[model samples]
Target: MSVLTTKEIMDIIPHRHPFLLVDTIEELVPGVRAAGKKCVTYDEYYFRGHFPQEPVMPGVLIIEALAQVGAVCILSCEKFKGKTAYFGGINNCRFKKKVVPGDVLMLETELIKQKGPVAIARATATVDGKVAATAELTVAIG
Candidate 1:
């Protein structure tokens, strides 16, 4: 229906501060697909320790960003409202480019399968229409 803001996401997922990778969800279709964004900045906490001399958003965080998008897809369910969605596992993850400060990452996710409380999703991160990273995320309603 409508896009979700950071506050709404905060209500659905338990992530906060540096751990919350997604800024806003642009589109959501519950059991089908979703899209979101995160604006990387030089002020991000991870960039400080990820590299002191040359700041680079860690590949793991990038995957986490994609997984967070998947989280949004699963939590779009009404039954899961006010519940915490945790990343159960990740598979087939690949990084094609390095994400740095000032990059606006676009996260896209599609629901692949689900069994009861667990769901699997395929996701990708892009910038300027180029793939930055991709992953298969598994989430559990907790």
Candidate 2:
């Protein structure tokens, strides 16, 4: 069961079409953790320019997707409601595999720590149970 639909996710995050990478929130614990999904398709706008022959989902976008999931976890909390989570920094980021069309990216983020308006989360993006990307993200809620 989905914890939040695309429409509901839109209400929580400011991202819109072409940029909103998260398709559904499968699991969520406000201010703690979140698990989301993004189904990469051949029709994605990025595919047009990212690579005409062998299209692959950009690594930066994969990080962005993970960040969006972290945002949902933080912004959904009553204390942080209506606030935006900005990327303060990214650390230990590593891309392990290529994500391409027809892949369903499973994104997960766990809020590991927080100080004032700043928070840190361990994030990961996986495809078919294989790690595609991993990072420690620092976010500032404002």
Candidate 3:
């Protein structure tokens, strides 16, 4: 699949600015897998409070970004179109690096299993080819 702009991604999943962590979809395979990007900047909303002196992107938000991309991977399916994917659970999550300003975060999620409205995916977030976070995500389509 070709690259997807924020607007195009928005068409597939329901996430908005600030809360919408994905800036673009670099690669997509509808229901199979997807890779997204988020350019972390110094002006991001959470920077002010996360650390006034030295900003660091929160780990949970990184997980959320992963989820958003995973949502795109799952929700883009023909039968799941226009539906919302909610987080059923996150497992084996780990944070290996601190994501900060000027870092372009690369996120990828691959759906490993699905049964009806439930799906499971393995997700990873990276910065400059270094792993930042990884998790197994389970979501329910509604």
Candidate 4:
């Protein structure tokens, strides 16, 4: 079950189709943490040109998905509602596994430090209980 549907998520974050990587928000604690999922498919836009014989989800997009989850965590707070969370930086990013089509990617982000308009989030992406990627994301609320 989803605490926030795709439609509802759009209300909190400024992401749309194709670019809207996150499908559902499973758990949310405003300004603190969030968990979301992305249902990867073979027909995804980038899969076409990325490789016809073998399609792999782009690492950057996976990182973006993690950022979107982090955005939801930050923007859902009452004070930050209707705002956009922009990436200040990404650090210590590591890709451990390739995310392929048909994989249900689970994304989680936890706010590690926050002060005023900037914050740091620890994010991770996984599939079938296996790690795919991890990063330390810095964000600025706008």
Q: Tens digit of lDDT per residue, candidate 2, span 24-51?
A: 9999999899999999999999999999
The TM-score of candidate 1 is 0.94
> CA lDDT of 21 in candidate 2?
98
Per-candidate TM-score against the hidden true structure = 0.94, 0.98, 0.97, 0.99
Model 4 CA deviation exceeding 4 Å by range: none
For candidate 2, give the lDDT of residue 128: 99
Q: Using lDDT as the measure, which candidate wins?
A: 2
Residue 15, candidate 2: C-alpha displacement in angstroms: 0.5
Better of 1 and 3 by lDDT: 3
Question: Is candidate 1 or 4 superior in lDDT?
Answer: 4
Cα RMSD of predicted structure 2: 0.6
Residue-level lDDT of model 1, residues 44-118, one tens digit each, is: 998778898889899998888888888888887888777777889989899998888999999999989999889
| Deviation from native of the Cα of residue 57 in model 4, angstroms | 0.3
Q: Report clash pairs, candidate 3.
A: none
How many pairs of residues collide in each model? 0, 0, 0, 0
Task: Give Cα-based local distance difference scores for all models.
Answer: 0.88, 0.97, 0.95, 0.96
